[model samples]
Target chain A: MGSVFTPRNLLVAGGFILIALGIWSGEAGIVFEKAIRVCLECIGLG
Target chain B: MTRTPKIINRLIIQVAALFAYNPFLHNFLTGELYRGGSKYLCTPGLNCYSCPAAAASCPVGSLQAVLSGRNTITSTYVVGFLLLYGALFGRFICGYLCPFGLYQEALYRIPGRKLIPSRKVQMLGLLRYPIFFLLVVGAPLLVVDTFGNGTAGFCAWICPAGTLEAGIPLMLTQQSLRSLAGILFQWKLFVLILLSALSVVLYRPFCRFLCPLGLIYGWFNRISLHQIKIDSSRCTTCGACVSSCKLQISIHTNPGSSECIRCGDCARACPHGAISIGFDIPTSQARTVTRN
Candidate 1:
């Protein structure tokens, strides 16, 4: 109950919101996947 | 951890997810709010792909294919989601979002041993690295066809999630797939059954050792914007928090260890109210430190 809206919560909540928005807007799993692709592209790992 | 809230939260999600057959709810907000294409949004701990309501993709399954990528970069999306989830949630995603984690908890309820501690347990934890590198990463490259679309290694060969979601459903619908099932399918089913059995005695065995997503998320626990704070002045060091930890942590010994999921159990456990969850880099706290 105490400090339920800490940064971690906000980040997670934001991540979930982005995901929902992506799907509802017809972009399935786009947020997480976009980040992954960007990272992999950066590292040349993908 | 008492696990009541965790269990109840999972139960509620399961009921809502299963409402696919609940025609009454289908006409209302629950159906529209909780149905297909969105599972890629919510990361249920269970890997319950069969559940009617799922938004986000199965991260592990995605990684397995991407790692064992054949044609296109399969893991690109999976890795992105994982990093975001990890950076955002730290390890709480395992507690609140993973469908597989929920399933493991349900299996663990009929417990006998409750926990088994060992060096082997620690050793087993290391296996994830190789699993992440090879199955999650390596095999896909080797096995993928000329076009390059790789098989979802862990899911195709070993993932419990596929069995829970795709495997069970495909068998139920297609008689031929049930007949087409062979040693590999049986092997995964066996693993699922064994993990389910182990859950009664062990807490989150998969999360501890096998899950690639858990591994990915755990890496960010230490540096995530939010952190579990241990006020040394208020702490008694009685180690009550350590004993209460189901994740095999000693909060007094290492309050900010990577194993922490930031579920706030230690905070809840401390009678002295020594623990609090906060963003480690608050502007005010940062400024104070800078001044000091």
Candidate 2:
């Protein structure tokens, strides 16, 4: 097996780190709130 | 010699992802969107959250929402999720998972005069970058109203997937929604109709030219963990792979080009057994072909 320090693995690690920060910052709750409510704009009402 | 198994596997995954992304079957009957816990997460594909049966949110929609709303935390999360998906699978998500992609392919299969993309047609693909930057990112972040709030410009204005999957279906089911139909809805209908007509001749016109999510995923195709690999030593340069590609990509010349959706058509077409798709480490190739 090659080293885990490949460019691809590094990007994946960065993604995970960002996700953790976002979650800790309560971003998931915000996504949940926005998602649960249907945006009429999306239905072309706007 | 039959590519049936590979085709069937991809088909199965496409159908399964379609249903799995929209599993709240009862919501379809009620004309209500699913407000489940899963809504917090975004689907890897372009399934609209407004679709009554959608179990999760659309990543593009979520990103736009967070951007327009100026919610940095949510923006971080949405970008991270998309990055993870892009890094892991690239546009394999488009080839084997997206409901919209499947729908377009089915439309293309309708017997008719097929149009192979010309050079000018291929040039039009450059439009997606502007669309991604302006509609998906810039407009959402910069265009604000009196309330100092921005809109999800792409979803509101251009997304044919939302129009087909959510708007039209919701309008058909709910009388109130139908009554609310205005010029915008009519315009969306026109866009959807035009795109559907075009899809009959040209393959995946939206993914090639308009889909911001597809563009984002394509950026990672060159470096994604799962990718298409070509063994130059095994290749006979038969050109079967190029002909088989509906997207008009040359896999042997550029094994993991950003334009490639990793659909495995090239691999299946390679009579020499030169091309393969998966996690290939310690990259090995005998020669690189130069196009003239």
Best by DockQ: 2
List the pairs of residues colliding in candidate 2. none
Write one digit per residue (lDDT tens) for candidate 2, span B1-292: 1122288888899999999998887887778888879898889999898899999989998888877775441378888888899988899899888999999989998998999989888999999988888888888778887776787889988999899888987898899889989999998888889889999999999898899999999989988977776778998888999999999988799977888887888888788888878654444321121221
lDDT (CA) per prediction? 0.57, 0.84
DockQ of each: 0.09, 0.78
DockQ of 2: 0.78
Residue-wise C-alpha lDDT for candidate 1, range B1-292, written one tens digit per residue: 1212344654675545434322233323221223343444435243533322334445554445335433344433444455566765577666555556667767776746677668677668787888777776767666676776555455555677657654654455556556766677677778878877777888878778787777777787875765676778988888878877887688766755777766566776788878776555556576766787
Off by over 4 Å in 1: A1-46, B1-53, B66-76, B278-292
B59: Cα error in model 2, Å: 0.4
Work out the TM-score per prediction: 0.71, 0.93
